[model samples]
Target: MNRALPWIIALLISLTANGVMTGIVLHRVAGSPHVSDVVRHEHRHPPRDPSDAARTGGFNVRAFLRSLPEEQQQIARQRFASERVGFRELMLAAQNAQQDAEAALRADPYDPQAAAEALGELRARRFEIEAAMEAIVLELVADLPPEERMNALAAGRRRPGGFGRRGDRRPSPRDRF
Candidate 1:
């Protein structure tokens, strides 16, 4: 035990020194620059402008797209591209309606009637756009095989978490929402 004693003490001291050096290096690096900004965790969807987000209404249809076979996906893309003008028009109409509503509200004295009319128009535009999107979705899937359609539907219900069994282990945050 005496022969090993000095070696053990030296080993412990070396380990302590190495640990202290490592901690100092970590502290210095963490404090040296914009570490928090640089070390951010990856997110599926990074922050985006509210207006840009409004384009999709938080409806992620990628599940359905990815579930489709390659040929079908190409067809769907072409179909969506063809409807680009319609989507753009709907977006512009909705944006203009919102702007009109805000302008009416900010008028010398708020014009409740004008604001209400603008909001009503906005709502209608949103519904119209939603319907158009639904139609496009239907068009995209119409040619898909039954199994593929089922896969896409499955993907759609699994965004935040799978809309699986009622007796699931735990409720997802989306469930609370």
Candidate 2:
């Protein structure tokens, strides 16, 4: 019993030591600036580009709303949630309209009337969707203070930089100004 007890005690001590060492290493790593930067980059939300919004099927107005006060943000979020249903329907209808228009244009012998009708349908769908989007945007910012609306607008207008991250944007020394 005595022999086994000493071994058990040693085992417990070793396990505790191992855990403490692991925690210390992790804490050091977590606190390190380079490590933190990598971690931050991993977790940070990328800024939204309005052009990408079309591909995403919805604009990220939610991200822009973060600049608003808490109460206003909540109101905006709720409005977005409600409008999403209508937005989804509009998207589907527009997609179908576009497909129909393309199919008409591709038809043999080129039925001008059919192509014109499809074009009208497609344009109507596009205008309706655009108008709906504009209405939603107007409603969203209508209650917002001008400053916040500006902030939201500015945030969305950020286009991706033309150069790659490491690519130098500055002109060469010999280049004319």
Candidate 3:
């Protein structure tokens, strides 16, 4: 027992060190740089008050649909009402499922076969969630008035552009040259 004490101490130290290193690496890798930017930008450019929508001719699906050609508006209203889950909710569910699977894998890293099976199930569930989201969005957008559909597409594009006008601003001729 006395001779084994040193080996036991070494094993504990190595395990503790490995756990700390793994935590640090995981935090860095999982941190969302884009989400931080979006939060910062929102603070800087606070959205117009909800009440201002009427005056600003801002895009509001319900309002836009009400104003669209009656037939188109009716279809859009029906489509919008029929959607089961919003895009954001579906994405969140998929992410949660993935995180749960990762946590399970971490808890039992020694069981490769079990981990692989868990991972496969997680992936399949994620795909299903994403497909449901896509179907919802497609169903809603498909029946929307053409103008409203265009507006929704444009709004979605605006989110990524917040990171940089890198999306729209063409490269200067000098840079190309």
lDDT tens digits, residues 1-177, model 2? Answer: 677999999999999999999988998888855554555555665544557755444444434555566777667667767778887998899899999999999999889999999999989988888788677667778877788889876544434334445762543453221
Candidate 3 residue lDDT tens string, 1-177: 699999999999999999999988887799845555557564455454544543444333333333345566456556654553564565676677778668767884467776777788778876776576456456656766778777765553332212335555432443211
Better of 1 and 2 by lDDT: 1
Q: How close to the true structure is residue 13 of candidate 2, measured as C-alpha lDDT? A: 100
TM-score of each: 0.54, 0.50, 0.35
Q: What is the per-residue lDDT of model 1 for residues 80-152, given as tens digits with 9 covering 90 to 100?
A: 8888998999999999988887888799877789889988988998889889988988988887788888888
In candidate 3, the residue pairs with backbone N, CA or C atoms under 3 Å apart (3 or more residues apart, or in different chains) clash, namely none
Number of the candidate with higher TM-score, 1 or 2: 1
Assess the local accuracy of residue 113 in candidate 1 as a C-alpha lDDT between 0 and 100. Answer: 90
RMSD of each: 13.9, 17.0, 19.8
Q: Give the runs in model 1 whose Cα sits over 4 Å from its true position.
A: 1-58, 160-177
- CA lDDT, every model vs. true structure: 0.74, 0.71, 0.59
Top lDDT hit: 1
